[model samples]
Each structure stands twice: as structure tokens, then as C-alpha cells.
Target: MSVTIETPNAPLADAQAMNEVASSIGLDWVGMEGIALPIEIAGRPVSATVNAGIDLLAIENGQKGIHMSRLYQALDELTQSELTPALIKSTLTQFIISHQGQASCAHLHFSGDILLSRPSLLSEMRGWKAYPFEIDARLDHQWMLTLKIGVPYSSTCPSSAALSVQVAQQQFSLDFDHQPDAISVQQVSDWFDKRGLPATPHSQRSWAWVTVTLGQDAAQFPVTELINRIETALSTPVQTAVKRSDEQAFAIANGQNLMFCEDAARRLYRALNNQCHFDQVAIRVEHQESLHAHNAVALAVWKRGSHAA
Candidate 1:
């Protein structure tokens, strides 16, 4: 087979040629783009399906481009092997050393949708869906190695629930008090009287991003474990399946344990703080309101195994 390729930059192998240009000029990060390759994520695995976004930056100044071909080859190697935080740390180390560590840090962001299989309630049907996820790996002399993972979830506000209940009751009482038609209103009033104006706490689409400092020679994290913690803390996990029973069950669950975005963020922050492996972590939640036009948000951070002060 033969090939003809044209481009604005030269091949990556000519490191010597690129270095001569870069050494003289002060530059930060440099590398390739859209270099597709399969990656074995921690929670999900698919062959030739994982695409990793690859880049390599030179620590030196005036560097035009790192060897794009070498970066592509590195990605190829990453696919055949395991794609873990530890592997990513090692990958960044290679990137730094390749360019003589001229810049102090190197990073790679790998993003892909992970397919999840969920069992339906009552129906026993198996439903599958994809969630957006990403792994951020970076290497620095001071920071050593840091890996961050992001997962999307949902949050509900407890205050909203109390308000809804109040509104439902007051309106019911005013419209139907002491009248023949008042019976239906009475029932509504009773329900609202028990519940408030915002009878249900607002639930919002949210995400949790966790950062970890890798131990010696470690590449990947316990992604499965991290995911478990997220689901557990949120309690009222949103679903991709919406059968009649599922909807009812979800409503019941949310109504029972109504939470605010702040609550959700605190829950996750505390959960990660208790974990021993992570040296630091950050949790954030965003609540999209059905009752209002603006979204509510909450955030928490943990450092050195303690909640950030």
C-alpha cells in the first residue's frame, strides 16, 4: 500500500528538528488533535470503540509542535493496554520526558460516553443508556500526578417540597371552604396541609467531578467504587427508563427524601472525604428547577482527607 499526505506541520519523528526550533523560543504546551484510539475505561470496556483525545506539550520555549506521529503511536499503545488513571499518569510522564520536560506539566483529557445497563422496575425489562464521562490526567513536579473523573447525576431540593405542600393546602381551603363542592378541595387541602407550598423539593441534573493524587506506580482508579459512592450519596438517582411504576417509584423516593443541591453536594463531599485513597476531591451539584427559570447550584471541596475550610 502507498499513501500521500499533506499538512501544515511536519512528522513527529523529527524531534531533533523540532527541538532546535523550540529550545530557542519559550513555549508551554503543544501536540496533536482528534487522534482517535480505543481506550479501556475503568467501568466500561469496548473494543476499538474508545477514542482518546491525545496531546503533548513542550516545556521549552518557542516550540512549534511536538512530534504528532509519536503522540498518535502512544495513543495506539494506550488502547491495546489498560486505560487507567495510573496509565494516564505514565503517559503524561512520557510526554514530559519526550519534550525534555521543558514545560513543568503535561495533561491528557479522555472523554467518551459509557453505556450502562439498568433493570426496569416491575417490568423486569433491561434498558441501556450512555452517560457522559471523562478522565483528566496531569503530571507536575509539585503536584506529582493528579487524576480527575466526572459523572453526571441529579439533585432535588427539600425546601421546595415543603413550599409545594403549603400552597396546595391554602388554595384548597380558600376555594372550597364550607361549600358543597368543598369536599374535593378539602382532600387537596389536607394533602397540601400535610405537604406545603412547594410540596416537592426541586431535583436538578447534576455532575460530580472527583480528583485523586496517584500513589507510586498507580495508573487507574477504582472507578466502579467511585460510581457506587456517587449513586449511594444521591439516593434518588435519575433514570433513563420511565415506565408507569418507575415514575411512581421515583416520585415516591424523591418525595420521601427531598434534598437541595447543597445537600447533594455535601453528601458527595463527605463520602469522598471518608475514602482513604484520594488525597483531595471536589463535588458540585446543579439543580434545574421545574418551578423557576433559574438553576440552583451547590459545591463542596475536600483536601488532605478533610473538608475544605
Candidate 2:
């Protein structure tokens, strides 16, 4: 019988060797990033493909770059079953411990689309849609876990309604001015005022970026709930499938609650402040206008007990 031998490449072992070399030289922020991996979202088990950016930062000034190989080796330990919070916590804990607590900080960036089934209003047809979402998680010596999320939504301009009404009324008045049987401009204006006519709301696609951090021994926070709050605060969420009824309802909802970019930002801030999950908060919202060539943006941050006005 003939015998054959094979050699296996060990990335983790290589990483450890690299870590030792970097440590001997004194380095900072040694880690591997932009790694692609599949994950589960909304229980559909879709690929959580993310460009995982990992950084291990040191507080002291004497260190050079960190042991990049060791960091990569540690990340390779992650498997499908080891992606949960407990697993992540343990991973981070080991990272700090393995580095002799020299690297006091770690950050992770993960993103994926949430594929969902939305029912059509008339035909009851199931439509599949993907909503893009991201998670920015970080750990520090303070035992803090910060998570950031970006949510896409839509906003309607209530201020535009008043202007639309004025323009439409002026046009009506000009056309009927010479007619004897035509109602006067005052009458027309009054009619529009009473019926809220001639008022058209302007709309734009909007997005909100929310960040939250927990204190040591902090209560459990459901990231999904925070996302839901942000969507609700924006007043209008992106629809997967639209039917006649859905379109009509959307219009009605927007008409009742028109907002500007500034309004959207404040609304989100208020919603988060009221929820009071973290001691500090930051919010940013942008409106990609449909009528203009440029986009409008608003931002707000608060660290005090109350949100900024």
C-alpha cells in the first residue's frame, strides 16, 4: 500500500504568530476588517454579508501598530452558532484578555438586508422586499456596548400645502375674473380654506441614523424596538408593495402629517428622548427632495437628560 501526506494551512495560527511580533514591537489598532460572512436576518437565515471592520485600539502612547494576525485569527473562531450576543460578548472579552487588557477598545461594523413579505391590498399577493440595515457595535473598557442603525423612510412637507393652495387659488381667480356668474376670488378662497383644497403636500425619501450605548449592568434593550420607534417617529415608512388602497392611504397619511427635513429630525429626536434608552443620543435625518436638485439634511445630538430643542 502506498502512503500519502497532506499539510493544512492554519489562518488562526498565523494570526497568533503575527500578534506576537506586533506586540513585541509595540503597535496600536491591529485587526482584520472587510471580511465577508453570511448571517441571519429576521429569522429568514439570509446571508448577513458584511464588510466587517474590526479595530483593536490601545490607550497608551508607546505602542505601534497592533498584531493584525492575532485579530484575524480570533475572528475566524466565529461560526454560524457563535454569532449571538453571548458569543459576541465572550469574543470581545477574550480579545481584551488575550491582549493583556492593553487594547482597551474594539469596534465592529455589520450590515444586511431584512427580507420581508408584504401583502398586497387587493390581490393579497405576497411581495418580497429587502430593507437595508446596518449595525455598528463597539466595546470599551467601560463595559459599554454601542449599537447604531440606519433606517430609510419618507417625509411629506406640510408647509408646501399652504403654498400649493395659494398658487392654485390664484389660478382659479385669474380664469374666473371676467365672468359675471363666476364666484368672486374671496368666495373661491373661502371655499378652498373651508375644504382644505388647492393644498398639495410635497414628499421626499428620508433616512435616520440612530446610535445608542449601554452602561455597565445596563438593562436589556431590543435593537428591533429602537428601529421600530425610529420608523414610527418618521411618520412614513417605505412600502414594499403598493395597491390602490395602499396608495390612497399613504396619501391621506402624508396629507395629515406633513413635515420638513428639520421637522423630521426633531420628531426623531423627540421620539428617542422619550424612549430614554441611553443617557446620550445622536440623530441625523436627510431628505432627498423630489422637486429640487439638491438634498436637505438635519442633525441633532443630546447628552443631557432631555433632548435638544
Candidate 3:
């Protein structure tokens, strides 16, 4: 009681291949963004968001669109190995090869948070800290790689500390004015215990954004090394596992290493400039002030041959 008609065998339609373009204008970049992927960083696997693209130069020849699926497939296949300069170069090469004559340049960007076990300042305890980092790669005339990282630290305002000290001195003078002859080390200690300081300097959590242009000879991303170097130079890296002793040590470190945003920028500039791996470096430091509505910031840049080592 039922009859069915057979369908004809025909090639599927491809609009990207068959459609005519409205204009022959070329695009600087064309591809995918916010692709979820797993990438190895610092000898561990972490989830990353990636963006892949290539220049659509063949549009001048009336090419309507690029094969975006090819870019996705290439990223899915090539990112299995540990991320390194060699791997990035290979990925970019695959992008160009997949598009053949349609693309001459390729770009890749990926970002992830890396977890590192950090020891307590003055204790045997340790805890984890996550560092957010980004890697950008491009291949045109030659390969170029850039590494960027955000580092959190404590910034104590030098001016505020000085003012705090002056207020403390004035308070001490007023308290011991009537008993000048009775002033002794023990009496002074007792007075400090009873009255404490009238004022305390303000400190706030701060950040340093470090960007570096890696030389072609760079084998791997130096994320941990760069973080350590910056933390050491600034000397007030935010703590993770903190005992009372560790907290006191951190407070002492902040007191001894008071700096403004400009000082932090200069310290990072000098620290990174001494390294031979980077051809250029840029630094931006931000102090999230507790006293003001606006944040304090400083910027600095260094080139390879422009400065003497």
C-alpha cells in the first residue's frame, strides 16, 4: 500500500566554493576565536582558549572565503605536543599549507592560567598560585613570538610611609615632652607598647604586566623564570600559605622595600634588560591605591641594541 520514489545522487552544494564575491577586497585576518583546547605549559597540561587566523590575500582574485574548518582541524591536531617555539612555528606552517595560495601569513593566540606550588615566606608549608599568561605568534616574512604575563605583588607608597614616620615622631615628642629627663630605652619601649603609632602607611595589592619579544633562538616559553625574576626584583610578591611568622616577614619586606609605581617599573625594566633571551621588553606597573579613587601606573620600554648591558 506504500510507494517511495528514489532520490537522485548529486554532489552536495558548497556555497563558499561556488558563490561569487560582491567585491574583491582582501582581509588582513580571517579565522576562528575562543576555541577551547588543552595545551601543555611548564611541563603540565592546562586548558587554554585559542584564536587562529590567516591573512586572506587571495580575495584579490575574487576568492569569496577561507576554509575555516581547515584552521580548526590544524589547531586540533598540532597542539597535542608541549607548547614551544618549534611547535608554534609548525602550527603556523600548517595553517599556511592548508590554505595553499590563499594565505601567506598566519597568527595564533592562546591564554591560560598556570598553577604553581609556592612555598610559604618563612614556613615549611606550601600552596598553589595561579598565574595568567598569554602567547602570541605570527609568521609572515619571518616568525615572531611574544609572551605576556600578569604578576601580583604588594606596593607600599614611599611618600605615605615617610609621612607616617613623621606623624609617629611628632606623637612620640608630644608624649615624652613633660618627662624628657626620664626618657630611657625601657620607657620608650613601654610607651610604644601602650600608645602604638598614631598613623600607619597605606599599602595595596598591585600588578605588573610584562611583555617580551623573544629571540628566534628561544626554545620554550619562560613563564616561571620570568615570574620568579619579577617577584625577586620587586621583593613583595603576594603570599599564598602564610603563618604568623610568614605574615610578619612579609610585612617587614614591604616596609623595607617601599616603592611607587615608577620604582616598580624601573626595577622590572632593569631586571628584564639584563637577560639575553629577549630582543625587546615593555613593562607596565599598576598600584591600586587605597587612598584615592584612581590607580597609579608607570610604563617603560627597552630595546636590544638601544641600551648598554
Candidate 4:
């Protein structure tokens, strides 16, 4: 006896479509975060941590769930292209299109370090420096793009420098008060060699967290330009490679640009506000105090035509 077996071809079931909650509530944002993706930054490929999502506004259809796979695939397609304002806008538009009527707004956030080769202050050698940066883009009624970066620099406390100068003056008075009318240059030189300023000002490594709202006309990310502008404004960026001359130059820069956190913030605010590409700018400066365990921080914000804080 011959036995006949028949196989049934059936479509796979989609749990997201079949299992819907009874409630008619809508969620603000629904999607994935911490998605690892490789992206091109500053014409170089870099590893980035990405967060992509969309607003769940389709409450009428019971809002089963968003198509997460589509979002992931859309982000994966970006690996071939360099990150730019236009690319980000198009990607977000694709996100909305992929969801059909399920989402009306989309958001994309990614963070990575942009490696830049920096020359020493006085040496001919150059070394790589990684600047941590983030890009946040949102599309709803209008497109909004914000760029943020962290820049490390040296901050010599102004108050501490003043106190050091005062101590040095007192010590000088004590050493030269009873000297002869015609004091020899060798004696003064020996005194300076013996006691180097009597007291030294305290300085610490500081960070400048800068965020800027890009204008709609911006085409490029301007990561390097922004970093350069910030470093110029602060005037004391941390060095990457250094020789003795470079170290001396760095020390001189720190001494010349004595600032508190507030001073640093103000410097960035003024510099960024002058740039026409930035519509809104926010600056946060933190001086990790060498004298104290706590950090000194200053925050400032500036709109295009509004007063800065």
C-alpha cells in the first residue's frame, strides 16, 4: 500500500498586526535605540551609536506597533553615504514613508568621535585627536538639526592666577626691599631662578560642551570647522603630541588665556553667535578644579536675535 502526503503552503502570521491592545492611547515615540551602525563622518568611516524612532500617532488603527525592521534597514542603507544635513533629512523622510500613515514625525540621533590630525603647538609632529560629537535630527512640521561636540582645553583659574601674582609680589618685596640702590641683573635673575614665582596658579583640564541649531541652508556637518572655531575662541585646546617647546607653548597659552567657567562660556557664545550657520547656540563649560574636588560649570544660550544668557 502506497501512502500519499500533502504539504500546506501558508503565509506566516504577523504578531504585530494580529495582537493589538484594546486601548486607543498613542505613544510619543516608539522605535529602537543603541543601534550600532557604521557611518561616514568628515569623509572618514566611523563607528556610531544610533537611535532612530518615530512618533506613534496612528491611534485610530489601534496602534499595534511600528515596523522596526524597516527602520533598521533604512539606517543600514546610510552606511554607503557620508552624513550630511540633506542625507539626514532624506533618511527621516524615508522613515515616515516606510511607516506609511503610522508615523508623522521622525527623529534620528547618532554619536561618534571624529578623528582629526592635530599639529603640536611648536613642533612639526602631528597626532590624532578624537572629538566626541553628536547629531540630532527631527522632522515634523519643520526640520530641525542640532549638532553637539565636546572639546577639551586647559583652564587656568583667574582667581588663582591673581592670588599667585599677589604672592609673587609679596615675595619680591621681601627679597628686594633691602637691596642696594643699583641692583644687579644677575641678582634678580638668581632670585627668579631660586624661587620660580614663589607660588604657581592652579589649572585644570576643562571641557566645552557646545550645541548649535543649524540653519536650514547648511549643507555640510561642519564638524572640523566648528571644532576649529571653538578651539580658537578658547585659545588653549589640549595638545595631542608635544615636545619641550610645544609644552612651553601650551603653558604660555594657558597662562595667557586665564579664565573661569563663565569666561569660557562667554567666549564660545560670542564666537558661535557670529556664525550665520547657527540659528541657536548653547554652551556649557566645565572647569574640573584642581584645587577642589568639585567642578565649576557655566551654561549659556543664544538665539539668533535674542540676548545671550
Q: In candidate 3, what are the lDDT values of residues 160-181, reduced to their tens digit?
A: 9999999999999888888848
Instruction: Compute the lDDT of residue 268 as modeled in candidate 3.
Output: 95
Tens digit per residue, CA lDDT, model 1, 1-309: 987667648755644344454455544456554545666766467433322222334345445555545555666557666676556666766766665644556667666666778665456666775655555565676435455555666555667667776776676666567667436656775755764454345666666666655555554656666666787777666677678988777777677666777777777777777766676676666677776888777777777845563
Per-residue alpha-carbon lDDT of model 2 for 1-309, expressed as tens digits?
987645445444433323333343444345655676665544555455433223444343334444554555565555555255555566666666666646676655566666667554345556775656665555674454555667777788776777887877787676567778857679867766765554466788777877766544444434557777887787577776787887777677777678888888888877876544576677878888887889888888877565355
lDDT of 4 by residue, 1-309 (tens): 997645447666676665366525667898899999999988878899999999876455464787789888988667878888998899899999988877889999999998999999988989998999999999999999999999999999999899999999999889899876977899889989999888899999999999999999999988888999999999999999899999999999998999999899999988887788899989999999999999999999988888747
Worst ten-residue run, lDDT, model 4? 15-24
Error of 2 at 24 (Å): 7.4
lDDT of 1 at 71: 51
List the lowest-lDDT window of 10 residues for candidate 3: 15-24
TM-score of each: 0.74, 0.73, 0.94, 0.94
Top-down lDDT ranking: 4, 3, 2, 1
lDDT of each: 0.62, 0.63, 0.89, 0.89
Worst-scoring 10-residue span by lDDT in model 1 = 47-56
Residue 108 CA error for candidate 4 (Å)? 0.5
Best by lDDT: 4
Task: Compare candidates 1 and 3 on lDDT and give the better one.
Answer: 3
